[model samples]
Target chain A: MAEVDEASKPLLRDLKAVGKKFGHVMYPKKSTTLLRDWDLWGPLLLCVTLALMLQGGSADSKEDGGPQFAEVFVIIWFGSVIITLNSKLLGGTISFFQSLCVLGYCILPLTVAMIVCRLVLLGGTGTASFIVRFIVVVASFGWSTFASTAFLADSQPPNRKALVVYPVFLFYFVISWMIVTFSPSHSDGTTDTGP
Target chain B: MSTTERNKNPNSTESWGGFEDNPIQGGGSAVIDMENMDDTSGSSFEDMGDMHQRIKEEEEVSEEAAATEEGDDGEFLGMKGVKGQLGRQVADEVWQAGKRQASKAFNLYGNIDILRPYFDVEPIQVRNRLLESLIPVRIINFPQKIAGELYGPLMLVFTLVAILLHGMKTSGTVIREGTLMGTAIGTCFGYWLGISSFIYFLAYLCNAQITMLQILSLLGYGLFGHCVVLFVTYTVHFHSLFYILWLVVGGLSTLRMVAALISRTVGHTPRLILCATLSALHMLFLLYLHFAYHKIVEGILDTLEGPNVPPFQRIARDIPEVSVALVNTTVKTISATLQSY
Candidate 1:
């Protein structure tokens, strides 16, 4: 009984520490402790939820069809891998897991944007819908790109920054394109959708 | 005889009648004699050797007298000497204690070290890191420092300046209209104070160890993005792209600060809720500003010159659809040519 009690004390302390780590994500300042002692749980959870959200938002669209859950996952996973590899090839020193963590967390703004898009779609379609969708996509893309680069940019050799940033730009452009083209089909079938 | 001469010569006590023989009278006369002896000190140096011998004998006699006095009233004599020393020591202690208390109070205002990053961080880096929401360690450490008291006031000053600049840019008549300027300032301060206090109260209820000043500073820091936006708008005139860029950058900056605060105090779920709530409030505040501007202008002009649409709504009109169309066409051309195969 005494041994069990002693074991549980450290366990409780660890649990508390984990909780604190999760909270630190919201902090504006980068916590070196968090960077040093990274975990996969939070990033994994966020990626899943974000993918689900993006899928759910596009699910109702008949034109160009919504992305499947697996497709969303593949896009994020593959994109992260490509970006991570590209950075490493360019003499960047960030570990694979750390790169993945940064990339995954960067999806948060896009996730929020998608959720907002979903709500906006519920209101109507046409110029207003396109406008809101366009703004949200652009904003989220900018945010994700900026966020990812902020973490990854410093790792690359100074002379090769543009080379490293090019892939990031393309990555965000593709995401933005997907978001912009995500048009929910109207039952009325008015094909003349104003740009 | 002077008290010093009397103290030097052991026989002087016998001539003057010993303090033991008449303690009250002897004590009174001893004080009087000491006062008179102050003027005769130069003349007394002539018999220094003789006086030294007498002083040694007097010390022996006084030591014996003190020993006897200890038996009769030792506690009283000891206490008298102690009281004199204790008064000086107590006063010294009290002065030191007050200084410590004042320093503790002054610390609530904030520390200069927290502002170091703002100066040390390169401008380009600030723009990049701020937009990405990747806050540096120093920026994070700023709020955690005990010296965060200055954050609120600094934020206020920056925000007020931004608002004034925004007013100048938006309205030609604003510079001349005292009432308008006053109203704008009042509204800005009122909103900031109200929102900061509300958040502070909510944080308090959540059992977070955040101070009112910290919350105020956080909110104030969030406005910095807007300050930049206003500056750009004032200088360059309105450009949709620049506006959106600044908006995102500002939003991220604010979000980062709020996240930092929430992470320290609340649980994960509560932190998310609080963050979302704060973000929504910020969006709402922006919306309110848009409408409020129109109302103020309409009231002043008595007729709306143009529809005061939210700047975000202009995004649709401003979007470069031509580029999007070209991209779409290129994709279609490639896909269709491949399908022909």
Candidate 2:
């Protein structure tokens, strides 16, 4: 074997090599990067902590005859802000506060659309109900997806952004509808009306 | 004579590189002499056959000894055992048993595709094989620190959004008799299929290392149970709400799996923010809808059914034409029905 230069060989090269070997197993390039950072973890931790706290608070509120809605909303707002700040700081294309603001923008429009769909389009057996539902779900979810992508992107990967947004929005649309249709009537169960 | 030539010609027992230094057989008489000197060695052709048999038996005994020694150290079976006819027979029996058990467990849901890979190996080998396979995956592919750190929060946020949205959709209405049943079934299948496909898709992208047989096996497991649920739901015309719910939940689960699989560069803060905010907004809007509609519907029902019904009934009866009277009666009846609930 020929003698090799010691200095020319980078110390970090071995780590990089190990990472490359691992890259084969992990699949998807994005996941590889996520494994390397500390800042990225902060928002995630915050989001989870807030979610649990909110859930517990809501449950307790219902038990204590306090309002559940406001508490839940506050938790959501808190989580969104933390996530937004984290994304911005972590080098997301989008700004820290913009993502959170987008949520506010989407809230009213989506609510109106859902209400309109239910009031004007639903009731009595017909294809109208189905069409309305499909429209509502697609429109709301589609817009929500766009908003999320825009909120997070400095410049998205063309259509890749939609992958995250569309499916999630549609999922929310359906789940929301299902919960409404199936959960016990507010009066019968804990329908916290307290302010 | 030079040391090399002297060793090569005479004793025949002195091989090049001491026989152990060079793993490959270097041509030398030392090996031949050792074989020739052994008591089992013979001159006749029949004796040669017996010598070969003895050699084979000795190798087998050594292998068994190795296995025993290694087994204590947690090396279950060697590659030779796995590749042997006995291993294949055991694998076949385990596979059959897995299929039967899976089928029974998912009685209504037939043809679940996601879980097939898990059941393909013999029951005995399943855990060992799975563990073996996971070792490389864990070391090479699974970004455990990252995935574990991110996944918990991601799941928690996702669950919250799901719950909130569900709350909004069905808040004030009469609990539809079968909607829950339908939603539960739908969610189960939807998540199962979504996760299964995502895994398959990831496997496809990752070097094509996973065999087609493996992918199909997993798909088979995933789809089998889910399909049964689909069949039951469609056949019985169970609640559409449930079906819709299932599709969404399944899609979400699948989406997450894909994201994780493709995570070559998960941009930390930005991704987290986007995920969290979007989820929160989705939940908030849904909850709003749930409360508003629920209250309105309940109010409408109450107005018709409580206190004001007798007056409406009298008015309905007094209407001149039967059509008008019927319409009035129906309106009052529906209003009452909703309000009373």
Candidate 3:
């Protein structure tokens, strides 16, 4: 027992020394600290931004306004969020604003395609002859999602990565609101509103 | 090393008779006469003959070894000078084995040496090429981002299950309606959410090679087809076969998309996500749209007919029927056209 105790004393001292080294590395001296440390402030800023987004209200309010317009908005917003997350996940090589720009640019072709679908499927022009427009809406929406994911997002500029991101998401939200507010309301022509 | 040297007379002891004639050779007296010593019992004329036989056996064994060594050396040298070196080397080793067998036959004085030449035929080149081609077509440097083959069939099965559940829910089977409906909703949402998340990950995090425009365009085409079918059938009272035909078109288009995805530089994870999302969103949107539209038309129908109106006085009755029929027909047609699964 005495011999074993003698062997363990050096080991105990070595462990204590290692612990002190670790503590010293972890603790900062005045000279080692920086004024503009992102580690200290970055997350705080992100949280504040996120709070702002949440405060913009539920993303589902376009249901009564226009499902098609709402859908396009959702697609764009979702894509922007993805871009933002992606940038953050990649150590902020991409920014929220850049993702927004990418999102906006991406939605352009999809919107055009959707408009074409609308013209093709619902081109009839009389009040009594309102064409069935769902096909164009759904097709455009689905295509927009696919095109944005596959093409525009892939082609986003690497340098201005995050700068274009947040704006794109906001654009999606705004466009969706516009689509809801402006789409031809079926309510105008119909008297029955209940189940 | 030759067999002939081994067969040379062992009786050449005449040159070494001085050593042979030593008293040790006769051994008449027990020199080391330890009590109960048994040398006389262990030695005899039979033992002498046995010793001769053992020596002969050892010489035969050594001769065989020497022959094999020579055989191997010849095989190696023969292989060195040959074209198609690898094939020749293999053939030479086999030839060495054959030569060994032939040598053994010569040693044994046997007649089994006649058939060795027939085994020397080279393999046919066409046969070899065919054998090579039989190897599986391996996709080299396959991206490990996702196990594509596994995920594809899995997604397909999930979609089928969802479709089955949706069918059951709409089939008016009451007792299991709740379960079917739950499963239908769950499957649709699960597939959509999962695919959407993966797409998000691929676009943002993985920096996928695909563009959003391409994806959206494909989906838009499908939706446009869907809407057209709905409108045509609902408004024009087209037969259900037109819808079926449209569905066939949708299927073919989807297959084309899949082929395109595979041929392009699209990664497996993104492609898989694309497929899953397209399927889920298409199903969810179509189902909801159809049911909701039906309910809207029903409300319109109820309001068009006042409570005390006689059958003859229903001016808008036919219009409601025509409108509902048009919507239903168009829905079915477009839904069929959009069918990828």
TM-score of each: 0.32, 0.26, 0.24
Instruction: Estimate, for each residue in B102-205, the C-alpha lDDT of model 2 and write its tens digit.
Output: 88866622333333222222223322332222122323244321211121223223343444333332232222333322343344334434544554464444
Candidate 2 per-residue lDDT, tens place, A40-76, comes to 2223333333333323422532322222344335534
Task: Identify the runs in model 1 with alpha carbons over 4 angstroms from their true place.
Answer: A1-34, A57-64, A186-195, B1-341
Cα lDDT for residue B122, model 1? Answer: 30
Error of 3 at B53 (Å): 99
Ranking of all predicted structures according to TM-score, beginning with the best and ending with the worst: 1, 2, 3
Lowest summed lDDT across 10 adjacent residues in model 1 chain B is found at: B294-303
lDDT (0 to 1) per candidate:
0.53, 0.36, 0.37
The model with the greatest DockQ is: 3
Interface RMSD of each: 20.4, 14.2, 23.9
Q: Residue B261 lDDT in model 2?
A: 29
Model 1 C-alpha lDDT per residue in residues B151-223, reported as the tens digit of each score: 2234234345335423432332222323333454566677667888887777776666678866765666566
Better of 1 and 3 by lDDT: 1
Clashes of each: 8, 64, 47
Candidate 2's C-alpha runs over 4 A off are: A1-68, A71-79, A82-90, A121-131, A155-195, B1-341
